[model samples]
Target: MDDLMKQLHAVLAVDKIDHNTVVKSVERNPYRRLLQEVLLERKDIIRSRMNLVALYETEEPSSEIEEILAQFENPTFPLEEINTEKEVEWQPLERKYLDGVSKIKEETTMKQTQLEKDLAKSLAHSEEVLKKHRDFRPVDDRDFSNVKQSITKHFEQAKTNLRGDAATKILVLRREIEQQGRKRRNFDKNTTDTLQNWFHDHRTNPYPSDQEKAELAKQCNIKISQVNNWFGNQRIRSKQQAIRMEEEEQKRLAALAAEESEAMQTALAAASTVATSSNLAAASLMTLPLVNPTMHAMVLPGMPQNLLAGTAGFLPQTNYFPTAGQMALADNGNGQPFYTDFENFGLATQPDSEQFNNYLG
Candidate 1:
C-alpha cells in the first residue's frame, strides 16, 4: 500500500506546471486551469487512486465511486464535486489514525528529519549553482558594447506588465548619456594642455589668479570651482615639500658647525699646556745660555715672522704672559676668525659683500 502511494505521488509530481512558461490569457489566476489540465492528463491513474482510498476506509462503493464513474462518462466535469468527496473521506481517517500523542510525536519527528535533509540538499544545490554563476565569465560581447542594451535587460522585464511609462524612462536616460559624453570629451581635450603649461610656468611659485582659473574653466568647458580646487591642492603639496627641504638644510648646517667647534676647542687646549711647560724648561737652560741662528732665519717678508718668533720666544719667559685677547687672536691664525663674525652677527656673512650690505639694510 505504501509502495502504491509512493508511485502515485511520483506520477502526480511529474505532472508539473512549468512555472517559467508565459501565457497571455485574460485571467490572472491561471493556476486553476493549470491544475485541471494536469488532472485531465493523468485521469486514468488519479481515478484508480481515488477508488482505492475509498475502498481502504470502507469495503464498499461510496458516493465518491459514483462521481468518478460519472466523470469518465462525461468529458466536461466540475472539480468541485470531486474535491468535496475526497476532503470528506480523508479528513476523518487521517485524524483518527494520527490522534494519539505517541503517533503525533513520531510523525512530527519524521517530518522534521525529512525537512532538515531536504533543506541541506537545497542549500548544497544553491551553493553549487552560485559557484557556477560566480565562476562564469560572460563570453557574450554584446553584454557590454552598448550601455542602453544592458540597462534595458536589467530594468525592462515583464513587457506585458509594463504600462506607458517605460518608454519615457528610456528616452530620458539616452539624452543624459549623450550630454555627459559630450562634456567629458570637451574637458579631456583642453585640461591636459592648460595644466601642463600652468605647472611649467609657475615652477618657482605656483599660485594661480582668479582670472586665470576662470580662463581655465572656459578653455576646459568645466566649472571655475574645479580649477580653483585643483590649484588649491597643488599649492598645499608644494608648501609641504618646501618646508621639508628647509628642515633638512637646517640639520645639515647644525652638524657641520658642531664638528668644527669640537676641532677648534681641542687645538686651543693643546697649545695652552705647551706654553705653560715651556717657561720652566727655558729657565733651567739659562746656565748654558746660547743664541740659536735658525731663530733669525724665521723672519721673512709678507709673513708674520715677528709675531710667530715673539710668540715662540715669549713662551720661555716666565715674566711674559699674553692677554686673553692676544691668546684668542693667536688661535685665530692672526686674522679675525669666521666664527667670531658669526657669533656677533648670528650668521656667516655672505661672500658677495654688496648683497650682504643690501640684505642688512
Candidate 2:
C-alpha cells in the first residue's frame, strides 16, 4: 500500500512537470509511465469507495458521496502510451491503411473531375443547340385566333338569323344556291340570235378575247363568264360540225374522181373504135383496082380533050389483068401488091416527045 501511495503521489506530481520534460520522460519510459497511470487510477477508485463507506457509517447526508460514486460508475479508459513496443509495431500498418485511403480518395476525386468536365461539355452543347434553334425560329408567329373568332361570330350570327326566320331564310338560301349552281343561263331570243350570227361569222377562229367577251356580255345583259362559256361550247360544236363537213367533202371528191375516170375510159374506147374503122376503110381503098372494065369511064374535069379521046387505049385490057396466081406472086410481104417485070411492056420505056406532049396537054 505504501508503494501504491508513492506511485499515486508521483502521478500527481507529473502534472507539475513541464510539458516538454514530461513528454521526454514518457518517451524514455513509456511502458513504466503507463503502469504508473493505471496504478494511480486504481488508488483513486479505492479512495472514493473508502470515503463512501465512512459516510454511510456516520449516517450523515451522503449526497456528495453519492455524486462521487456516480462519477466513478462511468467507465473511463486508461491513458495509453504512444511510443510503446506494440504501438511501434502498429505504426507501419496504420501508415499503409492511410496510404490506401488516400489512394482511393485521389481516384474518386479524379473520377469526379472527369465527370464534371463531361457534364460541362454536354451543357455547352445543349446551350449551342438551343441557341441555333432560337436563331432558326420564325420572326413572326402566325396567330389564327382572330380568324377563328371571326368564323365563330359568323356562325353565331347565321344561327341567330336562322332561328329568327327559319322558313323564309331557308327558301332564300335555296334560291340563292339554285342560282349559284345553275351552269347554263337562259338568254333572250334577240341575244341568242345575235350570238349565233357572230359565231357563224367567226366560225374559223371562234375564241373571243376578254374585250370581245365583255362587249358581248354587255350587249346581252349578262356576265362575261357566261359569254366565255357560251363561246367555248359553240367552238367545240362548230369544230365537230366542220370535221363532219370535211369528211363529206372528201367522200364527194373521191366519187367525182371515180366518175371522171370512168368517162375518160369510155371516150378512149370510142376513139379507138373510130380510128380502127378509118384504118380499115383506108386499106380497102388501097386494095381496089385502079381501072374497072365493067364500070363506065368518067372524064375528069381537068383532063384535056385529046387525052380523054386516047384514054381507052391507055387503059389496061381485060386479058392483061393479073390472074389470082400472078397476083399472089406480085404481093410483097406487106399488104400492098407490087408488080415486077413492068419493063417487059414497051409502055414502061420513055415515051417519044410527041406522045408525052400529047399526054401533058
Look at candidate 1 and give me any clashing residue pairs.
Answer: none
Task: Give the per-residue lDDT of model 1 (tens digit) for 60-130.
Answer: 33344344323223422122233455545445433432243234334444654665565455445433432
lDDT of candidate 2 at residue 78, scale 0 to 100 = 16
Clashes of 1: 0
Local distance difference test scores for all models: 0.39, 0.44
State TM-scores per candidate. Answer: 0.25, 0.27
How many clashes in each candidate? 0, 0
Give the top-scoring candidate (lDDT): 2
lDDT of 2: 0.44
Q: In model 1, what lDDT does residue 150 have?
A: 26
Residue 279 displacement (Å), model 1: 8.7
Q: Roughly what TM-score does model 1 have, to 2 decimal places?
A: 0.25
